[model samples]
Target: MKVIVEGLHSRGHQVSVVRSSDSWYIKETSPFYTSITLDIESGFGENFITTFVAQLLETQREGKSAWTRFKLEMEQAQKASELHENTCKMLEMLFENKEVIQSLHKAKYDLVLTDPAIPGGVILGHYLRLPLVFNVRWTSQGEGHLSIAPSPLSYVPMTGTELSDKMSFLQRLLNVIIFGFTEYQISQYVLPNYVCLIEKYLGPDTDYLSLFQAADLWLMRVDFVFEFPRPTMPNVVYMGGFQCKPAKPLPQHLEEFVQSSGEHGVIIMSLGTLIGELPHDLADEIAAAFAKLPQKVIWRYKGDRPATLGNNTLLVDWMPQSDLLGHPKIKLFVAHGGTNGVQEAIYHGVPILGLPLIFDQRDNLFRIEVRGAGKIIDIFTMNEDTFFQGIQEVLNEPSYKKNMQRLSRLHRDQPMKPLDTALFWIEFVMRHKGAAHLRTESYRLPWYSYHSVDVMLLLVGVVLIILGTFAALIRCLCSIVHADGTFRRKG
Candidate 1:
């Protein structure tokens, strides 16, 4: 059962990645901008491109052509850097690899899994005829047209603008078509005659939907207790709490520090990977918020500390969070609502106060609140009072603590760990020879497979036909005779 996992470079994978830099001919076939980025300069912190995309969102608010601006912004985003280009170009190279390409033509796969960003995974599933599983690690409602909910709709902020409630059907269709072209351009790793190339290669078929029916599973990084991904299909599995292990023992000093805090315990705060720099004002506000509490604050602030420091507040750039959550006396966990961080909180039965930033953090916090496991604080309005209120509410409310434990049990009670569940599903496909039969029900249904729009239309049409027949009969009867049974058939 040869399974290929794209965009994952963990030791757990089967294929040792061939570095693009080492292969001369492969590098020559590679996208020019992509090769430059892979040459070792742009790959380090290329996430600046996403921030750049975030920044361009402001200009998108200028005028009636906001949609135009939004479209241009997407173009600007891909053009902004080569990390994205290299990602697409690499897929293109793999597509060209005669060996890989031929194997795909005559699919020798049991299962194929990929991160959401790997579009080639879409192409591969088509070639290999394997079950596709999307293991989502972030907030990916997918690209513009494919987005369902909680996806940032437009790069531009929709509120306080002339934006319509939803992009009209025509607009959505256009976006789908546009996204298809964009994907092809991305595959080529440069701007070319996208429309002409798409027309020549793809014809007038205007659907951005990939051949995803080949995939049978979608392993969402969500837990039933914390995040509820829309229960749209049984094929999608939420295994967030599955692979987690109990936290290892904390260092002696840290354990002593937390336990020494007594009934006051300690507050844990970490902002995650990207935004390590704690703004001075937020730091001051946080410090002030904790000043009123009896708890000692362990803030994961990754920067030069302010000159003013309280005796109870500890500013450490690095803290092992798993160990922190398992600490004997940690009262509350204040985090940025990343999946791993939130999972740790629920994993250790610790109550939470989430200050989510962009991406799925909002959706993640919404799930947290919905689950009654935690409270969310908007990062923008996070002052001493708001922060204090949120933390205090969570700490005071015994239900939050109780709920955390309840979820911890449910998460742990599953038949196997999530990793095991994931592994089982992948292997299950191999044992069944690609499990293509499982997708038969979906294929049996028409294009309205998920929604049943066809059913709705059929019902409406039936009603209309019945009404029309009744009306015609009444008209003919009235025309023939009003009060008498006998009359000339037609005068």
Candidate 2:
């Protein structure tokens, strides 16, 4: 959004942002236009992470049985949903403030540009009766309007599942089940609470799903190469690598470190924002694994130093991830497999050793593995041997590097840059007054009709009617034949 806002501003369009105070990352960016920070106290941080990690640890401790793991996951999902509902409630309360409502009403914006995770924008757009453009920053992670992008449940894995694009028969069935669970999650756990909050102010007639489905455009953060090919509406525009920029010069320290590594090269390791620190034992194991490698390691460690730091390792609170990846000296990336980080690695043609911690990380890693560009190391059962071997395999193997480079070229071989594409659509919506023509009629249709389920039923009905008629005719013929035979015998 920061990139889009700045780009729009540069093109002489006025932009204003309504931000939640809880978003500490907002402070890092300086947008060209007005930023109205809602100072409401939404005390909700990502409180579920601690609980989620605890659950994961417990699941591991209990021998990691399939049933136990499934039960743990269910519990975790329930807790996370409850947390999100409370957060939504807080946002609802904030939006109900007289000052906030009056200010929003008076602002009279042309379009509401919003992140999909934030429900506030959907409500505001509905209340204002303006068009909406949902910016999905991650690759199909959130609850999306299925009308806009109908996900193929048989192939496309659900949000939390570790399944990949290609699936076995059983896996596909499980995928279907996961799809149903996802819908259940939305309808039963997520959307009702949001509907209550929206209807509280907007009245009973305003449907939450309808308002969300009414989004004029969706700027998804994905590329066809990285993501599996699935059915999508015309309104969905894939603007992958929108956040990628040309490599900049590295810092002096980083430059020196890269130069010092010589031909052995360096590896960049980062687990993303949510998982700030690794467990001490795990950290020690990782350090020990790195100690055997010839490549210098630049690890973004937020916690205390590991028990043993390899001489070839550089531990820092943060590193210029893109800049480092762009360097010729950087051989591979050890990442949590977040879409953005994975995209960045792909942009730079760097292979990866993925240690997926949670959420979409597992799925992202699966995609990379299927592409033959990376390997996944389970965080739960990651021994020093597996970690070291993963590093060695990716580093020594040429196929990983070759595949990554090939993918990188394919990703960059777009007709227009992702940002430009996104901007065009953003303006396209404005130029054509919401671009309603781009949306499929399926958007307004029920699921039964949208996917031609009704048509299937109609075809089935016709076939059934014909079959029934044929069966009756055959029975009548048989009865006549029997009657004729009986008459002959009596005569």
RMSD to truth, every model: 8.6, 3.3
> Which clashing pairs does model 2 show?
none
Among these predicted structures, which one has the highest TM-score?
A: 2
Summarize candidate 1's per-residue lDDT along 241-321 as a digit string, tens digits: 544566788878778778778888899988776556555776777778877888988888877775545778878778989
Q: What lDDT does model 2 reach?
A: 0.80
* Candidate 2 lDDT tens digits, 306-410: 887799999988889998999989999999999889999999999999998666688888888999999998877878999999999999999999999999999
User: Which pairs, if any, clash in model 1?
Assistant: 132-215, 242-418
Q: Which ten residues in a row have the lowest lDDT in candidate 2?
A: 138-147
Q: What is the lDDT of residue 295 in candidate 2?
A: 87
Model 1: lDDT equals 0.59
